[model samples]
Target: MENPFGAQTDSESGSAKSYALMTARGPQNCIESLHHPRPRAATRAGRSGVQSDYGSSKNLETKTPNSCPRKPTRFLTALSWQYPNEGVIKINTDGCRKGEDGHITARGVLRDSSGQWMRGFAVNLGIGQVLEVELWGIYLGLKIAWDIGCSSAVVLESDSATAVHLLNKNVEHFHPLATMLWGCQDYINKNWVCSIHHVYRECNMVADKVAELSSCLELGLSTFQDPSDSIRSFLSEGLLGVCRP
Candidate 1:
């Protein structure tokens, strides 16, 4: 069987196929798009076989009533995982879905201020959207942190800016993933001190790699008290303060 987590694959024609990560807009833009009403155009192709009905409003309508257009600023920044403060635990989590088979997986890793692994978990969620799985990762991470008595001070990080934005904002009850979002909010609103932030995927590779292990492991949630051999190097790199561009 092919490795779902592999960065590259061999094609039948003896060629190599590489997968590239998609870069999403910043949290502000994502939040605006989610909350504002925009004109819809024809349905077009989207990632992971999902059909997208959203289209550029510029083509549908020249301008909206009293709308002011501003050019978005772009800049380059490098990202790296930072250790938590004293007596605090940093949690990094990620969720992924295989495009071909539609297998959804979520994983999380918790580390202390010394950059030592506390606990890690991976779950095979069967099938779901990228956003749903992302929320699952956050919820599972928080649950594990609370169970381990580390809820006093915890910092949660996720690569999905949309997921982070949703948690920070007031989500509508009729939203598709409202229940899952509410569960996450319950943990955040607890007596503990938990903060969530959006980080680049490069800073979350350890959790990303752990999630990939679900593709080969049995269905359900798996916990790891020690870092796997596959992700040890990634953990080491973070400890060394290596930043990714």
Candidate 2:
């Protein structure tokens, strides 16, 4: 077959061919690819110095390219539970709050340089914000450590970075929990080798489990000298293996 506008076409053949000749554009005879045949008006626009409203001929090579979406890179950290230095006891604390009507519970577990659970405490804060519970956990953890002769050195760890920042005097804010902050600050000031840091929640599993258990108790504080079967499992899981990405 042939186009009436000085171009040829072969549609019934195994491959199709289409062409256009424009005398105004210096005998420009644009040939369309077998897959994409250019419309006659678009070919005429080329002669009138009009850019192709459609993409260029090169873009018609493939309607869709053969490319796979990239997968996101995975970041892995070998961070796991670690013991404190000699004469220093590491205290891991966590807090849990369920809902507006639920109770706020804070729990802390103290471990020696040998990773021995020296003492653990769980306080039922009745109902409070998560941040307040975390701060209370710190205050109680430090006080218990002091009472139990962990005074040589203390390394407090919490999952909540906000609470750790406040405890370490990294930032200051005035809230109802300011009293607990004052207590933590006073203890840190008096202790010569006291330090607080933020640890991944996986490394603080024992404290997290204890905190969840505190919410089940009947609105009171409880202390554990010998960890229960559940708490023991959480501590073992945290210390036994490296976290995989």
Candidate 3:
């Protein structure tokens, strides 16, 4: 099958495209084949520049392509998960949808300032859009943080840029995932400090692996007080500041 994440595949030879790996010293052109499954299509909020409930509203109605500023050029950078500030907790969340059966799942991991795992959760959301599933992961992560009495503050990180952008902008009331967005807003509006950010997929491997685990487990939500054996290596890499391409 063709790679879903837009990696060019050789039909005749069955070889995948190679990506350049970057390191602290410099860019090392290592030929390594990687395959990424295709994700669901984005909703209306992702297609247009609308204001989100969490941030200041922007008048996109009067804006045109020429009026909008050009996006910054993105460079290849090594990424690693960073520890949160003192007295703050960091939550990394990711959503995964299997290309074979379209099974959607969301997972989150909460770590302390010292990079110790506090709590984690995985939910099998059955069938849903990618944005909705990503939001569900954020909502559940915040709920878990609140339930554990995270009094200081919390920083949530997601690999899906669309999901992060949607949270910062206003979703239309008629959007299919409007209610789901509202649920996430309720957690953000609580009397506590919580911020959401977009991280590269490399920095979110732990949550990504956890989300993929839902394929074998029972449907519903599962919480973990201790790090599972499968994800312990990834968690250790985060603490060691290991960078990935």
Candidate 4:
């Protein structure tokens, strides 16, 4: 009868019998255990194979909490746009995107401490991601600022938090906008004092208006020595007293 549990066959039995007879001089204890495998010791981990006993670690349970994580609540505080300090200029930049697949536009306006527009630019980037356009606005705005000889204590403000975060880190990354960001950093290093900041979209109306111009204009890039009547009016309106929370 065939053994389902695989009892030794006749040939195997004959071989073992011969081998045992040849090794009759060997210890009886060693020879007895060779035919039957020993059962493994039971573990506290049960059938789930034990790695190391978790109970042995004193700090393991304390390190990991049993409760589920909760989301943090964020509140928005109203902010009013303001001008820079004495002998300083504030460059406000914004990027406009219609949608994920739509066109992108970058625009920026540089204003003196008195909120007078010194220079502004609008570039139609055709189509791109929002971050790319945001960084581009900073990059091109810095270049224009440098060209116009406003190198001292320039404060750049952008509504894009992502762009400000990257600028503040001052590190190179594998991001697609890394080149432009590095270029902006290079400008910052050359300047006496350059700082990038983040602001709410409502507080950045002047830059937003310039960015809106990029979407409507047919030009790839337009540098304004003097802003148009509409843009001039917009900047004049924004120069009013700062709104409070």
Compared with the true structure, all predictions reach lDDT values of 0.66, 0.59, 0.65, 0.61
TM-score against truth, every candidate: 0.69, 0.66, 0.69, 0.64
lDDT of 4: 0.61
Query: 1-245, model 1: which lDDT tens digit per residue?
Result: 53333322212111001101111332222223333232222112230111211111121223434554573444445566787789989899999899676778788999999999887776666656789889878978888788778857777888888887777666676677766676677677667677787777877879988877777744455566677567889999889877765
lDDT of 3 by residue, 167-205 (tens): 666567656566666656657666777777777778788
Q: Which pairs clash (backbone N, Cα, C closer than 3 Å) in model 3?
A: 51-169, 51-170, 52-169, 52-170
Q: Report the lDDT tens digits of candidate 4 across residue range 1-245.
A: 33221222223332224323322332222223333122222121221111111111112122333363553443434455676788988888899888667687788888999998787776666666788778878877777787778866777788888777676553544454555566566666663577667777767878887777554553245566567766766776667744433
Model 4 clashes, total count: 0
Ranking of candidates on TM-score, top first: 1, 3, 2, 4
- Index of the highest-lDDT prediction: 1
Residue ranges of candidate 1 with Cα displaced over 4 Å = 1-76
Provide the lDDT at 45 for model 1. 27
Off by over 4 Å in 3: 1-76
How does candidate 4 fare on TM-score? Answer: 0.64
Candidate 2: clashing pairs of residues:
none
Error in Å for residue 25 of model 1? 35
Clashing pairs in 1: none
